[model samples]
Target chain A: MALVLQTVDLQKRFGGIVATNDVSLSIEKGARHALIGPNGAGKTTVINLLTGVLRPTGGRILLEGEDITDLEAHKRVHLGIARTFQINQLFPDLTPLETIGLAVSERLGMGGQWWRLVGSKSAVVEQAVEVLDRFHLADVMHERTATLPYGKQRLVEIALAIACRPNVLLLDEPAAGVPEAERHDILAAVAALPKDVTVLLIEHDMDLVFSFADRISVLVNGELFVEGAPEDVARDPRVKAVYLGEEADA
Target chain B: MMAAEESGDASRTLVAQANAALAARARWSPLEIAFWLAAAASIFLFPTKHLILTEIAILGLFALSLDLLLGYAGIVSLGHAAFFGFGAYAAGLLAKYHVVNEPVLALLASGIATMLLGFVTSFLVLRGSDLTRLMVTLGVALVLREIANRLEITGGADGLQGIVMDPILGRFSFDIYGHVAYVYSLIMLFALFLVARRIVNSPFGLSLRSLKGNPLRAAAIGIHVNGRLVAIYTIAAGYAGIAGALLTQTTQFASLSVLDFERSADVLLILIIGGTGYLYGGLIGAVLFKLMQDWLANLTPQYWQFWIGLILVIIVLVGRDRITRTTDPIRALVQRATDRVWSGVRGSG
Candidate 1:
């Protein structure tokens, strides 16, 4: 498969702290990839570097073979790289429908049209509704996103990212803080995403990572410690010693 | 296959309802229609009240401009009067020097000048959080006020006087009765309000609301945050400039008070009274504020400030949401009715 995104020797340092150190990654087209590690392993820093939220101290980022290391966050989103926050970052007053509608309209380049009502753009609103329905948020589609349950807000955040019609999506802990009962809903929604879009999921939940990721990359101490098919990574002794530990043997 | 058809029908119903809700928000509600009609009818109902009415109209426009920044874009500014004073001085200088005697043309010139100022200072305002923005904006206004005070052409603190405006459109003179001035300011208010209304209902407005809600997410979703702020700030400055020009043109004078810090604080208070985010807030707030000021001044001319301050204190104590709570009954009725219709349609489907 063609590589959709790649980072070469990505490094970020804050003072004496090495947040992301000499990390290199490749995401292939339509790949179900997971980046897993223990706490403080620099998974989110890597995601931020990829999404242009934080500039890499030294590295190169390429999207579809074009260098995008110097691009702004919005510019990267415009280039079809979209991401969701580990903690839900949503407009408190806007409904899920309006939030997603704004994303869709923005993606379509109709966000600057001041003469027409947003509702008048039927195609954009329909697409937003479809995306929301896919996340099973159709019932509370018009309710304020901040008032929704934490899991549902997580779904809305992902829905917003997907509304951009991105070529590559980076989901940072989609199930974090979600109740155990609602974790399955998030998993199912993510699993049902179309395979034409490449996905990079950074998650701590091993069950979700094992079940959803076709290929897994384990990060230990801000470096890529191992990469393989899910079963192979599960069986790898080094990954076990560093991340999975005794759980891998079980 | 049957289940699929049912679900499709249900989804369609939901979409229709969503579209209807969006449409409802986009247009003027019945309350807004009533407000406009009452305002229009007041010209005849209170023929002697033109002077105060003109003041209300101009001040309303000023408050509306601030609302666009503070309410919609979430940019809190304490020096919005810089644009207002710039417009007033620009118009006054033009008329005093015979640069432009045409009222409409002078207003336009003043608006553009102040808009340029807004564009330049917007970078400064956008650089920091609310506190930094407040200090920066306040600093800008104070600096401009000192410049106007020390300048010769600005009348050196006495203000630019003898601003002789020609007949508006070569027709209606600004008579002592203030009929023409009242109508002129009212027309400008209605026209600009339409523009603001159109903007807030559009996609640009939605994007602004999104930014105000969460700038990080807005940027993550492809909104050029700083660019949007700069554009709206410039546009709002132009609106405020026009309001100041109206005051200068009608009153035939531009004074240092135009740039006073009180002007900025007063407009901010006006918006708080009316509630922000919506365009009508400024207009309604102006009406209530001016009428209360008139009544209180008559009752206690020397201590009216005390009463106005008290009212503001009450508003803050009660919370801004309480101002809108009185209208909740109507909003709830409409929402409940819509919900029933949607549920009914879904159940049948």
Candidate 2:
């Protein structure tokens, strides 16, 4: 499979503490890859590094064989790396339609057109509406996005990433804080994503990880402890021991 | 997904509805037109009060500039008067030297001059906390005020005097009654108001609102956050400069007081009174603020400021949102009545 995103010996240090150790990862194009780790396993940090939110102290990042380590965060997005936050980082005042419209306009390179009205371009509105409809956000699209239920807000987050038309989509805990009833809708939406777009799902839910990922990379203490198919990783004793031991400690 | 034929029909309906909603919002409502008409009528209705009306128009434009930064982009500056003073000085120098003595061209040049200042100082505001931005902006204004105070050409502490504005369009000399000044300032205010309205309603303006909502998310979604802020800041600077030029042109003088802290504070207070976000806030606030200031000063010349402070405290205690909410029903009622009257006229026609 063609590789889309790769990190080489990535490291991040805060004062004396190591947040991300000498870690390397590769995400294959069109692969449903899940990055699973415990609460402090540096999963979110990895997402931040890939999206250029946090610069790696030591290491290089590559996108489609390009050295994107030094690229700006928004430029990384322009180069087709889009991410959702672990916690929803959304415009509280913007409606879902506007939120999605902004992404679509930015993607279309019409973001700097100060003279054009918001709905002057029908293509943006069409795509924004399409993405909202796809994520089942059409009914409540007119309301402020923050007022929506957590599940729908999460869906809006995903829809924002999708509207950017990214080559590699990073979903940081798409189901986090979602009600159980609304979570299956998220799963359905996640599963129905376009086949060509590569997805890197950072999730704590084993059900989501197992059911969705074709390839699973288990992280333990900022290190890649296991990498294999879902079944193989599921069968691995180390992965089970870490979870069961943590469960026992709890 | 629904079947091909059905989904296409549904999506089409959706698209049309969205377009209609957006178009309606972007359309010029009758109320907005009526507001401008009323503003225009004030010139004729209170012809003897043109001097104060001119001041109100200038103050409104200045307030609009601040709203562009604070309301849309969430960049608050306590030193916005820097641009105003820069423009004031630029205009005074231009007119005093007879370099581009025509008022409109000089006004544009003054705007460009302030835009340069804004562009340079915008970088300083980009990296700091709000407090840092505030101090930096205030410092800029203070520094300029000091520079103007020390300069020979600017007339130092006594202010630039003997500046002459050319009769607008080679005719209509600025009469002593201030008719020309009020009309000229009002026209500029109206023109600039249209531009600001268009900008705040545009895609770029949407990006600006996003910046205020969440800068991090704005960047994550491919918005160059700093770039957007700088652009808006620079534009607002240009607007403030034009407003400053109006003060210079109408008064035929530029003073060190143009860059004073109170000017910045007064514009901020005007925005608070008018509300922000909506473009009309500045204009409405300017009217209320100038009128209140006029009335209070007449009532108690020695302590009008104290009363203004009390009024602001009352406004804050009652809450801006609650005030708007209380007026919502009245606004809706007017909107409905206007809509019916408009439809009736169209139907009869």
Candidate 3:
């Protein structure tokens, strides 16, 4: 697989603390990559650095072999980088359809047209409906996203990110706070995404990580401890000693 | 298997219906048409009310501009009247010096000048939170007021004088009855209201609303948050400047009162009274505020302010949701009637 995203010694320091220290990562095209570690292992910090939410102390980020370290967050998004937050960051007052519609319209560069009604754009609305259908959110498409159940809101968040039609997507804990019974919805949604889009999933659920990730990278204390196939990482003593521990089977 | 297929078909139908409903919601409702018609008819119904009506139009435009910032863009400005007063002075000075005697031309010039000022100051407003923005905007207004008070060109504290506007379009002179002023201001208000209506209904408006809901998510979704704010702020300033120019042309004078703290506070109160987020809130609020001022001030000439304050307190205590809730049934009733009529037309055709 060709490399779609690369980080070169990404470093982030908050005062005396090194939040992200000398981390390097690469995501291949069509790769279902997972980043897992113990608590405060800088999993989210690295995702933030990739999404341009936090500036790296000293490093370079390359998207499709082009340097993008200096780009702003929205500019990064325009460059086909999309992310979902650990916490649902959504417009509570807008319905799922409206939210998704906005993303689609923005992707199409029609987000700035002030003279025409957004609904009148049938192509955009159709695309939004299609995206909503993929997430199984068609039934509650008109209901305000905030009023939806927590699991469903997470699904909507992913739906929104995918609506951007991104080439590289960083999902930060998509299944966080979701109940067990509803976790399958998120799992199914992730599994259904197009294969050509590169996905980097940050997760704490070991079962989900093991099952979904083609490749797993273990991080300990803001540094990559090991990276390999899920099975190899699962059995590796170094990953178990520092992070996975004896819970590898469970 | 049969049940699953049926449910799938039902959901598809539901999605289609929901999309249609969303589109319908953006169109002009019967209530909006009725309200505008009644407003337009009022010009002829109460000929003696021209002066007050003209005042409402000007004040309505001013409130609408603030709504675009505070309601849609989530930018709370405490000194919007700074632009209003500046435009008033710009128009006043131009006409007083015979620099631009044409009313429309003067209005445009003044509006552009104030828009430039807003563009310059938008950077400062964008740098802070709500409280910080309030202080900065208020400080700017205060500074401008003091400058106006000290400057000889602004006639210092005495205000600009000896200003005369050429007949509107060189055809109709502004009369004491305010006939031309009323028509002129109403025309300007309607034209600008159409522009505002178009903007708020468009994708740009939706993006602004998203920003207002959550700036972080807006940016995460590829919206340049600060850029949208600055653009709306500049456009809003132009609208407000035109409103101020209307007042200056109608009254043939620009007074220091235009820049007063009370002016900004009053417009804010008017917007809240009418509600926000919707463009009509300003127009409705201006009508209610000016009419209440007219009635209450006469009833209690000494303490009208107390009554206005009491009303605001009641509005707050009652809550905006409850107020709208009470009217929901009536609105639904009207909606049903309109739907019936529309279906009848479709069926007959």
Candidate 4:
């Protein structure tokens, strides 16, 4: 299998504390890869490093063979890499329609045009509508995003990423804070994404993770602790011990 | 399965309605049209008030420039008068030296010149928090004022002198009755207003609002945050410069006071009093501000400003959220009507 994203000994440190250790990770093309770790395993930190939100202290990130370690966050997005925040970073005052339209327009290279209204471009609006429909956000398409239910807000976050048509989409806790009723929609929407675009999900929900991921990479203290098929990882004694130990500690 | 199919169809209908509704909202409404109509009528309707009306027009344009930066982009600038003063001086020197004889051309030249200054200085304001930005912008204005005060060409504290504006379009001479000046200012205001309207409603403007709401998220969606900021700041500077040029072209003079602190403060006040975000806020604010100043001066010449300051405090204390809550329904109603009408047309077509 071809690797779509690979990191060679990526490292980050805050003073003396290591946030992301010398952890080399790879995501194969068309792979539904899930990155799982307990609290403070640096899962979010890894996502941030990959997306250029935080500069890595050492090593390199390769996206389809190109070194992207030095790229800016926005530039990284343009280079076929997109991400959703763990805490749902969104434009509160903007409607879901406008939000998706902006993402579509930005990708279509109309973001810089001050002379053209958002509705002036049929392609942008149509693509935006399609994104809203796919994520089941059409019902609340015109409402202020801040006023949305947490579940819908999470859905909008992922919809925005999908609108960019990225080659690799990183979802950080897509089901986090979503209601029990809305959880099914989020998981189904994620599973129904197009096959060509690889997904790397950072999640805490084992049910969703085991159900969705073909490959599971468990992280522990900013390092890769285990990697295998979901069933293999699930049955592995070491992986089971890690969780049981954490349970005992808690 | 049937329920799912029905919901899918419902989603399609909603999205389709959204497409039509979006187009309708972007179109000009009757209230906006009436507002402009009244602005145009004022020149003829209040012929004797042309002088004050001219000032209102200039002030309105200046406030519009600020609205782009503060309201749309969320870039708080305490020294926006820098461009206005620079434009005023540029036009004054052009007219004084007979370098550019035509007023409109000279206005364009002044605007372009100040745009260059704004572009260069844009970087200074780019890498900062709000407090840092405030200091840097204020510093730029103060430095410009000092330079204008020191320069021989600017006539030092006396300001640039001997400015002569030829008739607009080479025919209409500026009259003492403030006839041509008011017409010229009004026309300039409307022309720029339309351009600003187009910009704020555009995709780029949407991106700007996104930046204002969340810069980190805007960047995540592939928006170059700093790049967007620099672009808006430069455009706003050009607009302010054009407004300044209008003042120089009409009054036939430019002075040190044009670049002073009060100019910046007053424009900020105008924007705050009227509200921001929408382009009309600046124009409406200018009218209210200028009229209030006029009437208040007539009634309480010594303490007019005291009352103005008190009104601003009252507005702030009473809160913008409370104010908008009361008026939002009217806006929502209009938007809903526009959508219905637009969908009706689309359905027929």
Best by DockQ: 2
**Per-residue lDDT value at A151 in model 1:** 78
Error of 3 at B309 (Å): 2.3
Candidate 4 structure quality by residue, lDDT tens digits, B1-349: 9998997797667767777657664787757878989988897799999998999999999999999999999998889999999999999999999999888899999999999999999999988799999899999999999999999999998888888789888999999889999998888888988888889888999999999999988999999989999999999999999999989888988999889988998899899888899888788889999999989999999999899889889988997779989999998897677667665777999
* Chain A vs native chain A, TM-score per candidate: 0.93, 0.97, 0.95, 0.97
For all candidates in order, state the fraction of native interface contacts they contain.
0.79, 0.83, 0.71, 0.81
lDDT of 2 by residue, A171-243 (tens): 9998888889888877787677778789999998898888899999887787778888999999999999988
Q: Rank by TM-score, descending?
A: 2, 4, 3, 1
Q: Candidate 3 chain B: worst 10 consecutive residues by lDDT?
A: B18-27
State the lDDT of candidate 3 residue by residue for A1-250, as single tens digits: 7899999999999999998888889889999999999888899999889988899999999999999998988889999999999999999988898899889888888887888986878778888888888888988888888899988898899899999889998999998998887788778877877899899999988888988999999888888889999999989988778764535645
**Candidate 2: tens digits of C-alpha lDDT, residues B6-38:** 999988888887775665556677779999999
Clashing pairs for model 4 are none
Clashes of each: 0, 0, 0, 0
Error of 1 at B165 (Å): 1.2
Give one digit per residue, the lDDT tens place, for model 3 in B1-349: 9998996787567557666767665767788888889878988998999999999999999999999999899898889999999999999999999999999999999999999999989998887789999998898889899899999999988899999889988999999999889989998999899899889878889899998999888888888888888889998999988999899999999988999999999999999999899898899999999999999999999999999999999998998889999988998898888777766777999
**Cα shift from native, residue B169, model 1 (Å):** 1.6
Per-residue lDDT of A104-133 in model 4, one digit per residue for the tens?
899988998999776788788778988898
Which regions of candidate 1 are displaced past 4 Å?
A: A179-185, A244-250, B1-10, B330-349
